[model samples]
Target: MPDPNSFLYNNMIKGFVDIGSYEDALTFYFQMLNNVYNRCNPNNFTFPFVLKACSKLTAFEEGKVVHGQVLKLGFSSDVYVETSLVDMYGSCREVVYSKLLFDRMCKRDVVAWNAILASYTQCGVMECAKGLFEEMPVRNVSSWTTMIGGYIQIGDSKEALECFYKMQKHGMKPDKLTIMTVLSAVADLGSLEIGKRVHEYMDTNKIEIDGYVGTALIDMYSKCGNIQKARKVFDGIRSKNISCYNAMISCFGIHGLGDEALRVFREVERTRIGVDDVTMIAVLTACSHSGLVDMGCEIFNLMRKDYGIEPKMEHYGCMVDLLGREGRLDEAMGLIESIEPDIVLLGTLAFACRIHGNVELGEELARRMSELDPTNSGLLVLKSNLYAVEGRWKEAAGVRRLMMDKGIRKKPGTSWIEINNVVHEFVAGDASHSHSKKIYSKLLELSERMKLCIPTTQRCQV
Candidate 1:
């Protein structure tokens, strides 16, 4: 056996990589490269760590140089080295390069297959991801998770659920990654029945729902429109991470309970949970929806002053909405002037201007919005409102005409009904069926009954 003391440096670097401290591993790698200590060839263990660091840092140029060195050093064909190169390229969104490396491998392993599958999934190649999953000689938990997550991204919740069932039937007991992937799929499907079943599975197996799994479950329930269930899972967890806090806050925001979301956010801050930019975004969005200008400003300032996170465009957009909703049109416009005006900020300002009867400013904002999104129906509709308010009926009609000429129509109003285990969506006058007559008769009867019970002026014309 190798003497332990003789391999101290190698062992130390391995420890760093194992714990995902890839940056530290690279520091050692460079030191060895410069002969700072006794020169050491990066063994199989060392190369993976270096590659991981390069992938994480998105140092594609460095990664290419490293790949060349691996080839020159006769480690190019090493399965581990090849797998890491594939991962590095995939992480960089160089899928073509990753595929080239994948094809060159003489012996393909489960990890190699999983890496390519995940590459396709992350790159938004859903069909390719599904094809790879079906073609893999051996599928691991990672492979299944990749396909499930890909389907979720494509908004094909039914396919994702089907893949989940198929994965289980293959006798693969899902680990934490698998559970997290399926939770998101179930969330997108908005199926509380499946979510409850997943909840039961976790309880029966006594799975430690503490980290990723806990956060995913909270997101699932929240997205399913069951904040109560999400809160229950959140409360049952023994320890919470920053992700858990972010998920719960997001849940509250989506449910229109912005105040409660802010309350949770404060508790998160008080408990010493690290608030990231994502956390700030969720809280800010909540404040915007609830028209909490002061709260939004305070949180935004805290994000910069305390957390040191620079406010990006999304943050500025939320602030504009918050201020605009409160009739602070001048303040919102001043903010846009002070910073880089994004489309969202401009649109919000336009909305405020329309509300406050400031046609000139509204028109200016509408021009900016049109530049950003040339044919946005919502923007044109708001501009038409401004024209209508100013007694420019012809201009308002011209705006609508322009919209029609551009093939952009107003989005129809939508309503949701959760029936059985699935959510059913309906639109007005969407009776393209043989029972249209009966449906219209029933609708008329209900309208008549409502009219009889209420005043004529209160009757719904639609």
Candidate 2:
């Protein structure tokens, strides 16, 4: 063992990398470097496995040192070692270095092409990724998924779906990862029809609804306003994991089905799935929306005491929201003050103040937030709305004036309706849409017709 040569050291490093013990792999790599008994050096085989380990860990500095060793040991032109170096640099987000090595290669294979392509995609350089993707003579499922995920990461869900459709048209069958990624794109767009299409495709293809796919389906259906279908998917899964249960609970929570969420939570407890931070957040959200302050408090206590999960920022946000919605502003404030200062938690209380017509509390929150972050236009809008809601028109106008002076404009409320798989977006108080004139005309007609249908006395009161 004291005089172990390169082969043994390489195998040991490869073992750790293969088992996903990346740090252990690097440790063995360093050990091989300091092999005092035989003065053994890492060969080309050792460098690739070592680089693979570095890639997974995103160990940029360690990878650089390995790269130096590769060059110093005259293994610089070795294809496997070069490819691994390319992948390592890519994973570390050093795209320039990755691209440099990739371009310097004498012959590029599918694996090499895919590695650089993934680097660009992972760094959100979609244009470069697309270019490289199209240039590659052979494209694999990973290539397509990388592009789709990159688009999704950049908030271009429509493009992501288009890429998935193109991927299908090219006779590339989607694996579970690709399906899950596409489902996420559908969820972001709230495209129920497309989500249903994906589900049907899975059924027709007989793809096993594993935990990843099941969780993705549940999330997609719930986001698309079909909680019943989401629950059906959850039920259909043969072996449900904590993720599936969390997604289902979140589905019900978002739809304000608090009781159903709680029932599912109890089922999770009964099944001994054991609650995590995510589970608590989902259940707390359900309670917050359904005005179940007492139940929320009980669950919050249960999370800390029974589950031994400390309250995260999200958990505290949910609790504050629940208590604030129930008009327990002081209680919410007291609880929040016990923790660190969080702008999101403060904003939650500010919203509650507006809802309950507590102008004093709202003003206090507004002042506090302004001091913390003057660039927060959303908080300014909330403060302004609070004033307007309580008939303080002068104060509301003053807030608006402050916004104008600071060159700040709040993002308008946006709503969307999908018809025949085409989504139409409406922005509040904005007439910039293509069909705005027609939409306004129809709205005016509806208003006149409603006025004519109402009795004169009732119309006056309205």
Candidate 3:
């Protein structure tokens, strides 16, 4: 072949990138750099495409070299090139460098702002992302979605909802991705009312209930204890995919409807849909809860033999739970020893031993568990409770003493109730709420009413 010009090389690189052949794009880039005949210099278009290939390939070192080349070629100030650089560093998990590049930019369009915003969001730096978001003079759907997604990624579902509402207040219409992300946040928060409003909005706006959004809605309703609504949504979906089926099955499991869950599984098996590990886990959990040991075993074998889905630790734990609940302690123990030991599995067995009054086995498992996780206060509490139930007062006292000496204290249980879209949290024995006095007065009134209702001869001691 003859010496190729920059135009020819640029076109070749762009074509490879457009076709998703990232390796070939990078290869052509290097070829252009090392070609003795042409010595083709990369233009602005060439740099972004190459940087994109670097981002996709996660070739950080190569990306830096390209950065240096961009500086040497005096295209460092190009907004497109700079945006690509920010994206590459962000994809490589180098948020600090991405930020530095972003800060140096003299002029930034929405694209550049979104790129940097995503970088901070991906790195779990919500504060910086929020700061940038507030400072951005112009915002788009991607910007809002990125911020909302960042909040969700960090388990701040409430904040995600807040951001979504704020976006609405700004007159920004949520796109499909935004709605899907917000629905996920709603599910995590169990904000059933808010989820219903979102569903209403989707209906009002005529947004298509695609597979992804439908699955999210199913999850939200199921987790919020509205299984009937979840089933309605499931039925409404015309084209049910495997994910849709998985969500419905999981809903039945969570509600302890083992028969319904198994029924759904059988239906899926009859269809062309394939069951994966998640599907099997849900089935096993349902079986465990309902004491369907034989069914659980059959499904567990089918998972491995027919579906080619390997049992993970969660699957084994479910099986152990099933066997242990049935008073088949020996089988449970055998299963535990056959698989790799996990804290959850051991804890389940230890609890089972206590329930069955198998003090000797409980003691052995407790010892092993302490060795595995010495700092777990729950385990110590369980051990003490076990000893106390068996009338081993001295051993129970010793366990308490050890806990005190180690300064290990169990976390106080907390519960939350949401009303009018505001979540109120209460800790056990807490009186910190503003309405605590009113709450206590109401409780005392109820107690008095209960006392009056009971006859003196039948009255029980407090």
TM-score of each: 0.84, 0.86, 0.79
Write down the RMSD of all candidates, one decimal each: 4.2, 3.6, 5.5
- True-vs-predicted CA distance for residue 265, candidate 3, Å: 1.5
Task: Give lDDT: candidate 2, residue 442.
Answer: 98
Once fitted onto the true fold, the runs of candidate 1 whose alpha carbons sit more than 4 angstroms away are 1-32, 36-41, 354-357, 373-378, 385-393, 407-416, 426-462
lDDT of 1 by residue, 101-188 (tens): 9999999999999888877877889888778778999988888888888888877877888888998898877888878888887877
> Candidate 3 lDDT, tens digit per residue, 246-328?
89889998788999999999988999689988888888888888878999988887887899888888888888888888888
Candidates' lDDT values, in order? 0.83, 0.91, 0.90
Could you tell which candidate, 1 or 3, scores higher by TM-score?
1
lDDT at position 457, candidate 3 = 77
Superposed by TM-score, candidate 1 places the C-alpha of residue 21 at a distance from the truth, in angstroms, of: 6.5
lDDT of 2: 0.91
